[model samples]
Target: MEEYFSAVRKMEQTVMFPSLLQGVSLGDLANTLDSSSNEKDLYESYTLLKSIKTMVEDGLVPLNQTFPVATQMKEQEIKEEEDLESLFYYHVSSLYRILTRLTRRAKAVTSKYDEIMGQMNQNEKRLSF
Candidate 1:
């Protein structure tokens, strides 16, 4: 049961979550007038998501590092009242969840990388023994 749960979490972090994150184009979301509201929401959501990804990749801090605040400020504006800040407050709970998942993924990836390296080193030692 424990092994099964670990495998499921690994799959969630590495395979499923990344697939959801990839191939998003903010530019296309920015364009398109008629559907601006929906697109804008998507853009904001993805922008926050990508920023979190960048922080993880850049190693600014380790996984599970607490973000400074809920919402990051961008130059462009969305709706007057329904801007990113407002949306973030409204969705603060979900944001926490997303951040937690991302942090888990970041840590999992690092752990997997370290494990592979350790295995390689062990094999090298065995071969040289």
Candidate 2:
């Protein structure tokens, strides 16, 4: 889990941030005349990824026992106690999956930006990433 978080931080620090700073456009996915809600610009994606990382860094996970979801939980689920280890595994697995996906997305966006910039050295282009 820590490794996955670290990878996301690295992506933000090394790839996405630099690409964004360079103004490598992602084709204005948001301002299109008939833009669909499903289309997210790379900058928006980067901000989301950064916000998630910030939340994780700030230890903002809701560990409260009486959280809102507690009321919505099924009676059977309320009565049934989940094993801590299993819950940890579930969350860790979920985190791993999401971090992996975000990292891949960051990489793809960087590649697209590099293409837009028409960079010559493939190795140099991806060196920081």
Candidate 3:
């Protein structure tokens, strides 16, 4: 169980944080777009957006699925009469909360990506002429 939590924390730090950072950067780039913005900047933003999309699809989504399973397994392992059960429950609950927040963050980032892509499409059309 300890190992499970450790693995989840590692995923959160290594996978989620970098993805979130990329999302933020992408959002910033999107917000800075204007008539003067060039294709190079748009390309870089699109590349970063693709990378983030892949990470969320291939990495974070799987990690998110594991959290609920981990919580369930931890709950199963708990003994009603055990003194340390509360601590275990606390950890499980914490995992659930983290999972919830992570999912929400991912959804927000996905929406931002969609919005940016729409803006980029418009920019591309403007540039084509």
Candidate 4:
């Protein structure tokens, strides 16, 4: 999980996110144009991934009523065996699942960004030559 998160963060820092986004504008990443283009969705997920992690790190869960992830997680956890250890395991498993999904999503967004960057590079090379 950390591996995936680290990999995605590295990619985002190095290439996935550029100041100019090459030829892709901020608008391109903000709104869905068509089904063939998913830049908007990817960027949304990218921001969401970061936002969720930051919220967790900042102690926004359990007390912060505005955190949707916490609310959703609470609703999803199994409501069986109201013992301390059982509840502990349930929370642990739920957190593990959420982290895994978020990290994998970050990696997928990175992959899509890499593909976009590659295409931009190819276009640049063609124009330069």
lDDT of 4 at 61: 48
lDDT of 2 at 51: 78
lDDT tens per residue, model 1, 2-119 = 3323533444344323433334433432322223233333224434444655554576564366455522332222444556687677567775655555444334443443454577
- Ranked by TM-score, top first: 4, 2, 3, 1
Per-residue lDDT value at 55 in model 4: 69
Q: How far does residue 118 in candidate 4 sit from its true spot (Å)?
A: 0.8
> So what's the TM-score on candidate 2?
0.52
lDDT of each: 0.45, 0.56, 0.48, 0.61
What's each prediction's TM-score? Answer: 0.36, 0.52, 0.38, 0.64
Predicted structure with the largest TM-score when compared to the true one: 4
lDDT of candidate 4 over 1-129, digit per residue (tens): 566468556656755364333344334433322234334455566666677666665764456555676567666554544676988886789888767766666666566577787888999999999
Q: Give the lDDT of residue 98 in candidate 3.
A: 49
Residues 13-114 of candidate 2 have per-residue lDDT tens digits of 556334453343445422321233232466565566677778777875565645576556645454554665776686689778777766655555545555
The runs of at least 3 residues in candidate 4 whose Cα sits more than 4 Å from the true structure, single-residue gaps closed, are: 4-8, 15-40, 62-82
How would you encode candidate 3's per-residue C-alpha lDDT over 1-129 as one tens digit per residue?
Answer: 333334334434333223333424433545333334333432343344345445644655554466667777766656543666787687789867644543433433445555655776899999999
Candidate 1 to native Cα RMSD, angstroms:
14.0
The residue ranges of model 2 lying beyond 4 angstroms of the native Cα positions read 1-39, 61-77, 119-129
Clash pairs (backbone) in predicted model 3: none
* Native-referenced Cα lDDT, model 1: 0.45
Any residue pairs clashing in model 2, and if so which?
Answer: none
| Over 4 Å off, model 1 | 1-52, 55-88
